[model samples]
Structure formats: structure tokens, C-alpha cells
Target: MALVLAAQRGRCCLWALRRQRWNQVQRFVKWASTIGGHNIGKILIANRGEIACRVMRTAKKMGVKSVAVYSEADRNSMHVAMADEAYCIGPAPSQQSYLAMEKIMQVAKVSAAQAIHPGYGFLSENTEFAELCKQEGIIFIGPPSSAIRDMGIKSTSKAIMSAAGVPVVEGYHGEDQSDECLKEHAKRIGYPVMIKAVRGGGGKGMRIAHSEKEFLDQLESARREAKKSFNDDAVLIEKFVDNPRHVEVQVFGDQHGNAVYLFERDCSVQRRHQKIIEEAPGPGINPEVRRRLGEAAVKAAKAVNYVGAGTVEFIMDSKHNFYFMEMNTRLQVEHPVTEMITGTDLVEWQLRVAAGEKIPLMQEDIVLQGHAFEARIYAEDPNNNFMPGAGPLLHLTTPPPDSFTRIETGVRQGDEVSVHYDPMIAKLVVWAEDRQAALRKLRYSLHQYNIVGLSTNIDFLLSLSGHPQFEAGNVHTNFIPQHHDELFPTKKATPHEVMCQAALGLILKEKMLTDAFRDQSDDKFSPFASSTGRRINICYTRKLSLLDGENIVDVAVSYNQEGSYKMQIQDETFLISGEIFNEGDSVYLRSSVNGTVCKSKLVILDNTIYLFFPEGSAQIGLPVPKYLSAVSSVVMQSGAVAPMTGTVEKVFVKAGDKVKIGDPLMVMIAMKMEHTIRAPKAGVIKKVNFQEGAQANRHAPLVEFVDEEAESK
Candidate 1:
């Protein structure tokens, strides 16, 4: 009866899916009318990666064609495959490719695309790009150039917000950018002020000086990053609201001068000042507060005659007193959370509004439905301050998508997460009836997202979402730092049972492969050809060494004649039996350890065994022999080393220069952020390994340090 009911339910789901697709087609047909009196048949996506794929998905659903402009590096990217037309503009560096406006415009002209969608990041909020689209007679599927200009500059946006009756943070948004003047203003505003570049967004060129002593250093760092990212280093000082919640309203405007907000998203949990997870219809907000947030956001939009999708960011205190932080004049990275609760396709709205149509739904017509969460999964080692990483996605598996779950991504399994772009692998989004349910769903979905290759933040995100404070929705920008101990608990050794399971998996996999080889060879059906470790009237023991991080564990497996085995780890021993099976595209291991049966997904790649159980995952490495390990390890002289792959932007010390501990050695730009390499100990610089604009791999020494005594000798 249960099987019958499940079959019926499956049919019902299929029917629902068919209906949804049909409805989408009907909606597209309706919107297929002329845009701005000219049929917008094709749109040129002026971006790359996930956002580009996101725009193309909507364009395809709307029955419109999409043209993708990619760098040479992205010639075979997923977005290129998805687009109706694709063109290679230039090489990998964004300045010559994705950010090259003239190349994109020429593609637009050549492709005869009626519009361009700057899908977040590069050229998304570029005022000049928006204006250039106008000059080229192409509809930029975003806000007006004037609006982008007004909001692109933090100082200008603050003045406009203040004039428009929006509560603005108290700070200096003045013309005097002198270090001394900014310092005086920071002193006036008080310590713990935010030093932000005027054109900063996505946490770039933003810093917090907790006290007056570090104000100048923080300011200079922010200026350098600002200059690198925006080509403008002018900064604005704002009172950094301690323990504030980052809430932002999603507002949309049309050429008809009508606008509305889609409530708010609380991006309070952040690292390096960028949002890690986002949820919509902010956790503790009341209906009254929600209405006011929406109204204020709409007012800000109308103030600049904004069009298309825009996010108005606010810094809210415990008392719910909100102050304008800044405005992102393009679609936000976390926009899907807003869409989940509001049941709106914002990209479609962007396309429609850009075509000179009114917003499909007004303020009263829009209703917030359920709670949603978006957790950004990046290629980074969370234990190492979340420093970004780049490599191949050797194996990737995500939870099945449904009505309430989404995996927004651009790269696929076996694709490289390049060093030249943001390290985000995908955005895992989930929705449920309420906040707690949504939180639970988010955790469950995260557990199913399995990846094998370089380091990832998946385990860290799991730890974060399951934290007591985060589960209760009591989130703030400093939540991670405040709960560091709980979030980053001391490492524990791998459980004996898990290690046993890892050994069994390895044993079973090897036996299977050996059996396959024997079956294909002339030794087929030969008793001696079996590698099952079975000997006549004798038990064979095989010892294996596995590396867990830096520590190694030795496992002894004693094979029994009856196909079962006894595995010993340290002093613990367990009888284990397992058979590996190939299911669909995944490898599964059904193992009985001490008569406790369990199943786990197994993936072996790059000398590491990855075991994904229902609850969690484990990684066990096959230790390389000492001789090979020594040969592969690159030894470097005592010096400052790069934390990740990036370009050396500036070198502060020359060869033979004396430096104290913690002195700046050089600056590197990587994964769209700036990192300063500081001296490890007092020494004289023997040699500089890289100059400005030279690429450096992770852990590569930037400077060779010599001892003071040796230099004196």
C-alpha cells in the first residue's frame, strides 16, 4: 500500500511539474510583446559565471534569446553552452574581457541584440557602461545611468538619502579626503568608525578601525583596495554600528515612475564583511517594521528615478532603528532569497521593466509567503580565515532541486574553479513554511552538497547553521567572531568507527577493481587471481596508513575466510563487511561494522577517500611514502608567503631591508580581495621573489628572509 501511495505521489509531482512549465510558457508568450515598441528578440549578457547563467535561464523561459560574451578562459563555460549565441571578447583578465565595455558593445551591435543584461559584478553597476548602452541604443537591463552614478558613490548616495528623508548614518561625506581631515572626522564620529571607499560594494574597500590607533593604517589599506577595484580611492567615514543587523530591501522601479519593495533580507551573518548566508523577511521584524522598510526603500528608489531591480542596504540596531548603508543599483547576489518568499522572478521583472513596462505587481499585490535562506558556498579553507582557493571540482553532487530548493551555479563537476574569478561554487537556497523550518531545511540541504577536490566552506557552513545562536535567528554582522569558540571548536580525532569504515571502503574498492581486472584477463575464475585476502586455513593481515589532516592513523585489517574482516584502529577492533555498488552516477558502500549496518556514499579522488554519510562526511587521505612526500614538498626560506594564488600588487621592502615582526612585506590581489603579507619575524630581506603585477601561487615565498646575525656577518 505504501509503494502504491508513493507511486501515486510521484505521478502527482510529475503532473505538477508539467503544469508549472506550461504556465511559464504562457507567461512568456504574454510578455513577448514589443519592448519599448521594439521587439527585444535577443539580450547580450555582459557578465560571466553563475549570474550570467541566471539571466540566461530567465531569458530562455521568457522565450527570448541570450547572447553570452566570454573571456578566452570561459570558452566552454556552462553559460556559453546555455546561450543562443556566444562570443569570445578577449583574454581572461576582466579588464580586457568582461569589463571591456567597447568589446561588449561591439558584440551587441554585431549580434543585433536589442538589450544587455549586466548580471551583477563586472559592469553591473558601471555608470559609464549604462550610459554607453544608451549611446549605443541598447537597453541596459538595470537602473538608469544617472541612478547608478548617484548611488555608486557612497558620499553622494548619503547626501541624496538624507535629502530624501531617509535616515542616513552620521559620518563625514565630505570633499576633503586628506588623511588628517579624515582622522579628525573619525575622532569626531568616535572610534569604531567604518572607513569605506566611495565606490565600494561587496565588502571591497571597506574596513573597521576599532580604535584611533589603527585608523590611519585602516584608511590607507581601504584607499589602496579602492584604487585597485574602482580606480578611485576617495573614502567616506561612517560610525560603525556595533553588533548591527544588515537588512536590505529589494525595490523595483519602472519607466512609468511606479515602484515597490519586496520586503527585506537579513544578511547579518558575514565574514570579511561579505554576506555568508542571507534570509528573507528578516527574522525578528514585525509587520509595521517591514512596511516602513519597504516604504523607505521605495522612497529612495523614486528619489533617483531608479528603474529595474535595486537593493537598498541598511544597518539596523537592536531597537530596529535603521540607517541607510548604501544602495546596490543592480541585482544582489542574495536576490533569490527575496524571490523565494515573494514568489517573483526578479530577472523577468528586470527584462520587462527595461522594456518600458510597469511593474507587474504593485505594493499591495505583493505578499511575503515563506522564509528562505541562501548560503554562499565558496572554494576556501574556513579554518584559514576563509582565504579563497582555486582548483578543479573533481567530483560534485548537490541535493535534488524541487519547488523549495535551488542550486544556482555556473561550474559543473570536473570544471575548474579558476583563480581569476570569485571562488563561489554555488548558492544553496532553501525555503520552508517558517524561519525554524527554513533553517532546518537549509541544514539538510547543505548536508547533501558533496564536493571533492580543493578545500570548501561546506563543513564550516554546516557548523555555522547548526550553532545555537544562529538556529535561534539572533544574528548580527559580528555573529561569527562572537561565537568563534563554538563555531570553530577544537579539532577532534576521527572516530574509530569512521576510520574503520574508511578502511573497509578502501578494501572493498580495491577488491572490486582487482576482480574486474582478473575477470577481463586470462586468470578469470582462477583461485589464485582473487585479491580478497583469503588463504587456505589462514588469516591475512594488511596494514594501511591514512592521513587525517596532519596526523596519520594506522589501520590493521585481518581478513577472514568468510568474506568479513576485523579492522583494528589503535586499541579498538571491529568486525566489518562491505560491498561497493555503483548507483546511478554515484558510488555507494553498504557496510556492516560490528553488526551495525549503514550505507554511505564513497568517492576516491586525488589520493583521498571521501565518505558522505547521511548525517555528515569524512575525508581520509592515503599517505604518500616518505621519500615521495619529501620530494614533492617545496621548501622555502623563512619569509612571508602568499596565502593564496594572486598578483603581487605592491612590495614594501627591498632586498637587505631590515624588518620587524608584523611589518608589511607586500600586498597581493586575489579572488577579488586584497591581502597584505606581513613579516613573520625580525630579519633582513635577502631577496624579493615577485614584483608588481607578477602572479604568485599559494604558499610561494614572496621574500627570502636572512637572519640579522647572518646579514651582519
Candidate 2:
């Protein structure tokens, strides 16, 4: 009893000390502000989507009026609905709306906004915009314009960090664009070097040069992308940090020359340099390393007299050595994880700090509580190379009983997933006592998440969360590509599982027939009679299996409504609705099988289904009957097409242009990656549908692939 009392006293003492330290930091931050009261009023948010909604939530909590500026495409957006007042800025394209400095400023003035909060993207990092706000006497709820300017250029930021005694990856940030110069730098830094654009972000204008041959090809590609993206052909070469963990520290500063770090977040789980999953209190970082990282981040922030919220990103090697990468002088997409663990509303802090209020907490007062994880749910198809998917979102439902896990979504059911901007559908965040617990929560939440009418990467995220290495907290930069086969294994289900599914389908079909008969007549029919009667017809189809065998199964299905279907085999009947496929054709099922019933989750390829069985799991291809067509136009047209997912850097043929076989049609840019579309056969461009800057969907026609030769002949 005495020992327990002592332990409790010790914990109380620690809590008091933490509070005391926070008070000191707060005192220092608010030394000047204490003379005045908190007076920040109306704030204009210059962005769209969930981020705008997220900032508005904090503003409402602080009793501050938030005015949202939206584009024509976002007039019905959730952010616009959440704001105290909303106004239209421009058309759908980002440049004319969210990125328009004059329009945003004009809206702020008209709305009587005293402060402007640029959330994450768009004009968030535009130093010119920040300076304009400062000149207009409007508080920019972000870092100083000078800080943004200094960090906007990768070369200058690296120089700044290096001067501040922060380790930086050895590279050539010089302005020389000669191939010889780049080759020499690459050789000196080693073969596996990364080429990047100085004025670009979001993984754009970046390429990995592994060998001599790859160097030349990547150099040209990088230049082309840089020229098109930032209108700057200058590139920087840096040594690739092999097997590195991407970790960043969130820091805040005040005009009183005081700053504090909020620990670190692990953002190594990325796709094409864009983080997909992030977690607070980085998985493998220990206390000592955390302290060093935090101090370094604070020093970097202090070097530029940074005010407001900013993040200092670093790449840590296997040996725990880290190098400063870049600083993002804006609120990050993954800031919710930090908020969950620290109990601090960063947007509120930004407002308070911008109002000349000091940070009320000291570094020592900032206590690391539990672990938190964030997953970016995007309207993208992971199986289709992470292409941006677009269509009317028929359904957008999140996991129920939002406990420690929180969902932040901008679009609801009936909303359109347009190709006008980023494909981030929502952000799902979960918190727990530790990393493993957080992972478990995240996995469960992902499993329960459902988004229909458009493809998404939810299943991929679930698989990544459940990955052995990821759960073990041992993943690095190349984790995805290294384990691609294992992560997305290609295997066929056992014959017995197939038989069980068939049996279940049969049973379901019999039940449906009996139900229909009973509904039509007063008398009920037995299950045995229905199964034995010639009234029921079974269809069989043969498909190639992954295991070098053939799969044959009987498909029995019925329609509950237009475009909605239910398939039955034996005792198991799978309920499938939304976007129906070919009539009476065998379709692959990707589902989680429980006992005699298999739940259809994600439909993989047209013919492949991921199935969860009672005993184990398997992938089974549904057999298409011999009477059915090998290729069904119904199934092909039913699938959602990718639009504006890729960067259309160039459109070779214009409308009514004469062309030949396999001529380059257009290009699509996505996730900073580029893909080229070509003509199918010899033909004249009947109609060039898309323009250079206009984005295209997967099935959206780029150009008519008519056979010109055939027409001539």
C-alpha cells in the first residue's frame, strides 16, 4: 500500500513539472501579448477540400469566423458548407482559383478577413502571396514570408541547413545544367543519385538515376518535367539515401524568439515520394534520437526566425544518422496525428501566434502521450498503378463507432470525385497506447471503410498496414517495390474452396427461386424440389488459373434492382450491388469468406476475386460459360475509367490531324509520374478531345483511333 502511494505521488510530481515547464514556455511566448488580449477575428482560408474543413474546425473552436474561398468546381464542396461564410474565387482549374493570388486576396478583403490561412497546398508555400498578405496588413497564419522564400528553393534551403550545423545529403545544387557537370556530380555522390527540380515539390521533376544509361535518360526526363512543371529547367543532384526512413519534426515559433519541437512523425510509408501513411512518435526512434531530432528541427526553425507552424523533414539511414532534407513552411497533410497525441490544436496555435500571442508551453512541457497513425484514402486504383480514379461517388461511408480513430472526409455520398485536383478522398487517423495498437486500429478501420462508384486504394492500405515488415516497424524507402510479389501475391484458390463457393451459390439460387415462387403463390415450395426442378439452370465457365490449372464453376445469379445483383451457389449467397457487369456471365470475386458465407470486398480484375474462406484465403477466377462471349462489352464499359490521373505534358496530334499507326496521342501526369497514350492502329486524328492543360479520365477519349488506311482502301 505504501509503495503504490509513492508511485502515484511520483507520477503526480512529473505531471506538475510538465505543467510548470509549459507555463514557462507560454510566458516567454506571450510576454508581450499578455499586455493585450487575444484579438484575432475573421480568417479567410485559401484552399479547398478536407484541409479547409479541418482548419475551419479549429477556427470554430477558438470562436474565430472562418471564410472559405472556393472554385466553381467546389461550390458544393464540404469545406464551403463548413465555413461561416463562403465565396467563389474562379473556375475549376486550380490556377484560376485556389492558386490565384489576386482573387484570393480580393475575397479576403471583401469578406473582412483580418487573417489568411493557406492550408497545406496551393498558395500555402507561395512566399509572394505571404508577402502580399503582410503588405496588406493581413496576418498570414503561417511562417514569415522570408522563411518561405528561403526554403522555397531546394538549393538555398540545403545551404541554410548546412550553415546551421545540420547534416545534409552531399549533392550538387549548383546552377550548372550541363550533362558533364551532372555526370561528374553523380559519380562523386555515387551512381544511385536522385535528380530533382529546385522549384518543384510533390515528387515532381524528380528521377532516380541508377546506372550510366539510366542517368542520361533520367536527366532528359527530369529536365522535361521540370520545364513543364515549374517552367524552370534547372535541376539538383543528390545522393540517394538508401534504405532510409523518412521522419520529420513539427515545430512552432513565436515573435518572442522562442520555439519548441513536437517530437517527430514517421512518413516512410510512401508511394513515389508522396507519403500514404504517417505516424507520430516515429516507430523506431528512441528517446535519445528523438531529442537530437527535435533540437535540430528547432535550430533549423530558429535559423530563419520562423514563426507559426512548419515541418523539418529528414532522411535517417539504417545506422540512425539523419540528414536534413527540406522544410515545409506550411501545415502538413498529416498534422492530425500530431494533434491526436499532443492534444494541441495547431491551427489554433497559428491563429494565436499570428495575433502576437506567444506559445504557452515549453519544450519540457510537451509530453509525448500515445501513438497515432494517419492513412490518406485517395480516389485511386492501387492495382492500376495508383491512377487517379474519377466518377460520381455513389457511396462514401466510413467505419462506424469512431472511437480513437477519426475520419476526416470532404466528400459525401452523391458527390463527384472530379479530376480537377488532387485525388485525396479523405484522411483516416487512429490513436492508441503504442505503435502496434495504432496499427491494429488503423487496419480495422480500413477494413470497415467503404467507398463505391469509384476505385480507391483502401484495400492496398489495409494490406500495407498488415504487412509483416510494416507491423514489425522495419520498413524503409524501397519496402513496397521490394515486397511487391509477396504483398500482392498471385495465387489461385484450392479446388475445395471453389467447390464450396459453388455449393453456396447453388443454395442461394434455390432459396431465391423458392422465395420468388412463394411470393407469387400462397403455397411454399421445399428447397429439395427447387434444386431438383428443371426450372433452375446452372452455367459453367472455364478460366486459366494462377497455379497452372483450370477453374470451372457454376454461376447462378439474380438481380435485386437495376445494376444491382445477388449471386448464389449452395448455402452462401453473395449480395453484390452497384455497377452491374455482364448478364449471366462468370465474374471473379474478391471477398472475405467467413464460415459458409463470403463477403465481397474489392473486385480486383474483371475475372479475379480476392476471397477469404473459413479455413484460409484464396484468389479464384470465375469461369465464363462457353456460350458467353469471351469479351463482354457490358463488363468493359461498367468499370470506372481513370481521368486526369496522369500528366498530359504533351498532346502531339490536334483535332482533324492526319496520323499513322501507333502515333503518340497524349500524356497523363499522376503522382508526379507521366504516362503516354498512343493510337491503336493507323488512323487520322478524327477528333483530339483533350487540350494540353486539360486533364483526362481513364475512359475519356483522347483521340479517335480510326483506321485511316482502311478508310482509304
Best by TM-score: 1
Q: What's the C-alpha lDDT at position 474 in model 1? A: 95
Error of 2 at 20 (Å): 13
Q: After the best TM-score superposition of candidate 2, give how far the Cα of residue 81 lies from its true spot, in angstroms.
A: 1.2
The parts of candidate 1 lying over 4 Å away from their true place are 1-29, 33-37, 525-528, 535-539, 635-637, 707-713
lDDT of model number 1: 0.90
Across 1-713, the per-residue lDDT of candidate 1 in tens digits comes to 99798667656644554554456557667767654355677999999889999999988877789999999988889999999999999999999999999999999999999999998999999999999999988989999999999999999999999999999999999999999999999999998999999999999999999999999989999999999999999999999999999999999999998999999999999999999999998998999999999899999999999999999999999999999999999999999998887778999999888887899788887777768999999999889889899999899999999988999999999889888899999999998767887899999999889999889999999999999888888999999999999999999888889889999998888888887888788956665557878645545887889988789999999988889999898888899988898987899999998999999999988789999988899999998888899887776557778888899999899998989999999999998988888888888889999999999998788899886568779
Model 1 clash pairs? none
When superposed on Cα atoms, how far off is each prediction in RMSD? 3.7, 7.9
* Candidate lDDT values, in order: 0.90, 0.74
Cα lDDT tens digits, model 2, 1-713, are 99798667656744654564466456445443442354467899998888898888877756679999989988898999999999998998777898899999998889889999999878898888999998998888899889998887889999999999998999999978899999998998997999988876777788899987789878987888887666687889999988899999999999999999998999987887778989998887889999999999999999999999999999999988999988999989999898777767787778878988778577887877778999999988787667766777764556764546778877887888767778888999997756777788888788667665667888788778888999999978788888887677664546544544433433344455675776777544534344323243433221222321364554455544342335554466555432112222222233223334344333233444543332333455555565675544332221122345554677777756666655666666754357666566555555666678776655655666445455577
In model 2, where is the ten-residue run with the lowest total lDDT?
Answer: 539-548
